[model samples]
Target: MSATRTGGRNGERPVDPEPLPHPVVDNHCHLDIAPYAAPDEPVPVAQALARSAAVGVPRIVQIGCDLPGARWARETANEFDAIVAGVALHPNEAPRLDAAGRLDEALAEIADLATDPRVRAVGETGLDTFRTGPEGREAQERSFRRHIELAQDLDKTLVIHDRDAHADVLRLIDETGAPNRWVMHCFSGDAEFAAACLERGAYLSFAGTVTFKNAQPLRDALLAAPADRILVETDAPYLTPEPHRGRPNASYLVPLTVRAMAAVRGADLAELCRAIDANTETAFGGTWGA
Candidate 1:
């Protein structure tokens, strides 16, 4: 879904940060959600790719939050050599579809779209108590379980989105059993919570939020996470990194987050980049694009 930014720096696009010493994949991004682009204009996919590639982020996993988005993700992945697709009804979306009595129909379409070769993951799924309330919890959990099974059955990576529902997310994973490969996208957990997820064999994908001033806990998680289990993402048009916090984000800005992550973990920049690059391949069930 496209996120609307209001006031001040939100309207400004930040200048690109220095390129990374080594390339890495943006494991999660909504290239289709172009809040900074002109109305009715689809996100400038080619331009975005070029900008990101120029900054050492040469590949991206385009995530689809709904049926329309799922189809677009598959089509975009097919058109671009530097992109792969992750298709699913987002956590908030599930409750809405269920309320409309169309959840099953939408999920069936996601399953079909997921079968496409360019679609490498079944995700952006899980729980979101922050946006969804008790009235929707059952539908949300049900959808999360189905997506988990779909990923396992299709042998695709599972990319989970947990927002203010950490325990329940872990509970569902424990109940359903995780897929061979799974990621905690935009991981918003403390070091202790991070250990819990890591114990489940999850790859914790950190985003620009890790660079926020109030995100010391997130940084602690990054520091505690093992090198091979860490991944990076932009979640673009959303979690733009520091010095550019309120601006519209794109994959080109990944270096800022990766640099902050390296500093947090007190690790060598290029080595951390190399590990994240390799971890993404393992987490996502192999490499795609350039």
Candidate 2:
């Protein structure tokens, strides 16, 4: 069974201004930024969604990191038929969740999220040595483990968030024995690191960083990524791709990064669209082949 409203090659309907290059899947985005953001926000959710729709961002995983944020993610995604939810404790925010020590509480929160059919993946979780200190490392590790367990228990795909802790993240994934079809969200490591993760059955997702001229290494690594294993993300309102780089990011901008990914993979726009769209659908437990 497939979602008739938003799936496959015919997932999109025509919008304004420009023709959509192709339908895209925004692998990750934090919609929970509303609390910290201004109430009279310039970029309203509808506006952001319209922009995304305009550019053929047919599906997006609105990730929720904190307790309130996760709840908001659900509400926000519910507002749009095409958007889905990916609920998890971001590494930096993992300390706020007591999943490792008070697992029942954490499980309850997860169950609350999972009860909603649209919450597709279980993360934005994993190690982040670049930001986490020694005191926070233990909690981060515990949170990562709990997220893995949560994915296993819920039978949802895991969206890993690894940053400057590639080795540690790989160790944890190996030690825990991850379920099939996990995506390394916003993968930041080099080609070798990507290869290592690929060997472990984890898909490497590239973000707008690959579009940076200085990101030649990311460019090279992307070439090594097999078509079946490559995915694209915005990590928005951050990592906006070129021309729009450094500006507020959104799912609508996914096509820019998708174009860059296609160039790296030596695939044309159509081929890249089909491949990435299929991989994203598979990652989120949706049927891709029509």
Candidate 3:
């Protein structure tokens, strides 16, 4: 029950990241950075992998932020029987403006990273307007489009991150005429945005944040979403659900979110579990623990 910690950035030994006692699917986590150190510090990848398996997350997709993270995501996933990989250049991780000339090349590197067999999805890519201005927004969009195209080309599921820019995100999805079968991970949009994404045939993923009492509006949106299109994730080492709200989040904590989902949709926990388990498999193209 000790908190995990990692070597500073790339060289420190991370804290113990043991798994938990619930059936869970960690749809998204930066395996290379699972909160081992202080809030802003990086968690050692090894601990993250071990912790994921220890918890009963039947399947997990560890995402990468850059080239090295890409390699590690694949290698670590390949090593673990239950872990899978998702590679993408996170919006803020993309190179800065002056060096933005390398953005396309950087994103291409990520797409190439997805070519690995263990890589079942293509992002954590999308807009992050909450923190970025116009220029950064433009860069995020450029990178996001490529991620979508890569997923389409590889026939892999797209993992989208739509924060406050839901409208623009929808516009881009329409413009790309991107194929259906993507996942809107950690869906924070309102009922309207949920409708827009559902219209595009994109799958919706719910996280622990939806369990908060103040998140009833979010629950309302979840209620509006089609059950088949719904999925669940720990999004851990972040967004831990109620009861464990302030605790360090992990895949094991997903059942709480699952329970919350059940409460929101008025379904039984077992049925809710089955629904999301199926949705998780579909989101990853039926590639579970393989």
Which candidate has the highest TM-score of all? Answer: 1
TM for every model, in the order presented, reads 0.95, 0.86, 0.85
Residue lDDT tens for model 3, 1-290: 12222322222222323333335577887655545336455445555545555655566777765666777777878887778888887766663722558887777677778888888988877877887777676678778888878888998888888778888888888888665579898999778878888888988889988988788778988999988888888666667677656556656566667777887889866666666767878888775655
Off by over 4 Å in 2: 1-20, 34-42, 96-107, 287-290
How far in Å is the alpha carbon of 164 misplaced in model 1?
0.6
| Order of the predicted models by TM-score, top scorer first | 1, 2, 3
The prediction achieving the highest lDDT against the true structure is: 1
Candidate 3 Cα lDDT to native = 0.73
Q: Which ten residues in a row have the lowest lDDT in candidate 1?
A: 1-10
- In candidate 3, which residue ranges exceed 4 Å CA deviation? 1-22, 36-56, 95-100
**lDDT by residue for model 2 (1-290), tens:** 11111111211212233334668788898644521223224246667777787778867788876666677777877777778888877788765454346534764686668667777888778888778777788888887887888788778889998888988998999888887679998888788988998998888889999999999888888999898888888886577788765455667778778878878878888778878888888888885221
What tens-digit string does per-residue lDDT give for candidate 1 at 1-290? 34222222335567888999999999999888754534344457898899899999999999998888888899989999899999999999999999999999999999999999899999899999999999999999999999999999999999999999999999999999989999999999999999999999999999999999999999999999999999999988788899877777889999999999999988999999999999998887775652
Once all C-alphas are superposed, what RMSD does model 1 give against the true structure?
Answer: 2.4
